[model samples]
Target: MHQNPGGLSAAEIHTERKEQQRRRRNSLLLVVPILLFLFFAFVAPISSMLHRSIYNPTLVELIPDTINALSSWDRTGTPKPETLRTFSIELQQLAKQRESGRLASAVNRSYPGATSLINATARKLRNVDPNQLAQTGHLALLDTDPRWSETKLWQAIDRLGAKYRIDNYLTALDLERDAQGNIQKRQSSNIYIDLYSKTLSMSLIITLLCIALGYPVAYCLAHAPARIAGVLLVMVLLPFWTSFLVRTTAWIALLQTNGVINSVLQSVGIIHQPLELLYTPLATILAMTHILLPFMILPLYSVMKGIDPSHVKAALSLGSPPFSAFVRVYLPQTVPGLSAGSLLVFITAVGYYIIPALVGGTEGQMISNIIAYHMQQSNNWGLASALGSLLLAVIVILYWLYDRLVGASNLKLS
Candidate 1:
């Protein structure tokens, strides 16, 4: 029973250390479920999105022979005779396997008419002799679909050879390659950049609106008596009890032309006709600001509550003017809450989908709406993933900037 420095027996000390280690292990085990959930729910999807945004192997895997053959051909126009021969041969094989539709879909994503052309030709070439397809590949392909002679279709086929490329990302940014292979702005369609700009602008507007609206409410709550503050806090959080869809649709009902607001305004003789409100950017901004206002207020109230009133009181008692004391003393102390609330509201607004989709019409559509369109409607998953990845990149950059500029340690929750 040898005793160590603190007069405890060696065995007791060992048992205490073992108990501490067991506690640490238990704590880690308790967090394991959350760590696993985050990995599966958040990390895995984002990792897949980042990967899929660039890597697409559908065409390369489907038509390996053609992809290999087209390796050396200059993409000025259609490929060489042998490359077309290889592609024609692969088309017959794919048609035999009933996988030509997949090829058509993959190609049609880059070049629209390829679906009709490829499917039709694959059907025509399905029964063609494989040996003859190998011999007169270009002729057979060209004969089946005269459109095969088109340079654009051939260029699209040439592009599929790169199993991993940023072509989708480039397209997401409203850019495409020229005939000479230099990336340039897409002349045919340029909607994404504008939508991205609108998204950021709308999010900023929502954040500012939240600050404007939330700051005063938070100040009141922080300064009020505990009994009154509890009632005020409940009022602030009352919105959370309502369904999100209900809240959003409530805005729709209020903003729509024959709705309560318009009817009330008309009754009050404010205007002859109902002002156009629904389906506009203003509708989205207002709804988002309202929905996110609580997020702003909570952080602000939390920070402002902890701040010592004496600091402002002392500044005032020292003969400082009220405005000057507030600006120089109290406002500086509230930076933590302001930064926390602004970042929270802005991030949430930036990624917001449901409210905007329901309230935001064409005029108010954000980048998220377009991303959803590409994913759900057009099924351009690659483009959607690229857009999402780019958005994620932007958000990460913004978050890093915020953290660098404002210091993440002071965000009220802590």
Candidate 2:
């Protein structure tokens, strides 16, 4: 064995390294469960959602032969008789599998009212033999349904037959691909952009309101005596104990036209008539601000509590005015807290679903509401996923901007 100047043998050094490696392996083993849980619970779902946004496999999976045949033909002219025969054969298989509805639904998403035409053709061809279908050409199929010759139907099929596409993302952005495979703005009323803008605007307003309301409360909590601060902290945390749904319902009851706020105002002779308060943008902003206020206060208070009062006092003793000392010396120290709290509140507000749904009327509904509508009501999971991905991208971009401008490293809880 080799010996070192410190009298450590090579074998002893090897054994020590092995021991360290063993400890590290054991430590890593302890965290494996957490890592697996995070991957399955968070990462897997997000990845699946993103994939769903771009994956369009229903048509290709059901009718591969038809799609393969159509791929060779120039899309400008009418589909040849051989292509029609191939599609008829595939339609027979699709009906045999009882998946005509699935294909029809998928096609209808691209071309409205296509489900009926496809279903009718499938029904007419259900019992026809494959040999008979081959013998009869495109003209016989056209006799069954004139739509068989229509370019729109074939184009819709070609559009829906892709295994993977960006149609969902384009639709989410209120855009579409033309027949020439060129991107174009949709002719329909564009609503997603409006909803997205509204979501961001409302979130910003709520963040500002939270900051305005939370800064003073946080200042008081941070500077108060121990007993007072403890009481104040409990008061701030009291909202957490209540359920979110319950709090939202309470706000609705208080903000309704004949609810507590209007009743109190009328009783005090402030207004002669009850004002409409429930189901408005004002109600949404107010409820969201209240719900998210504690988030802002807690972070601000944590950072402010650690600030040294002596620094501000020293500035005042140096003949600086109290307001100037505060603006110049003390305010700058709170930047970290402000950034942390504002980011927290803004992100949380952007994803809020329940409060807005309960209190927000037509004018106040947010993009999250639209996402939910597509997922649950319209049965448009692809569109929902695309919208969700877009929202996630926006958040990531905002975080990158915040990191660049405000320096995320400067953000602190305490």
Off by over 4 Å in 2: 127-131, 408-414
What is the C-alpha lDDT profile of model 2 across 53-125, one tens digit per residue? 9998888898898898889878866798899988888888888889898888889988888889889988888
Residues 331-358 of candidate 1: C-alpha lDDT, one tens digit per residue? 8788989999999999989888888788
Off by over 4 Å in 1: 1-24, 408-414
TM-score of each: 0.91, 0.93
- Top TM-score hit: 2
Q: What is the C-alpha lDDT of each candidate?
A: 0.89, 0.89
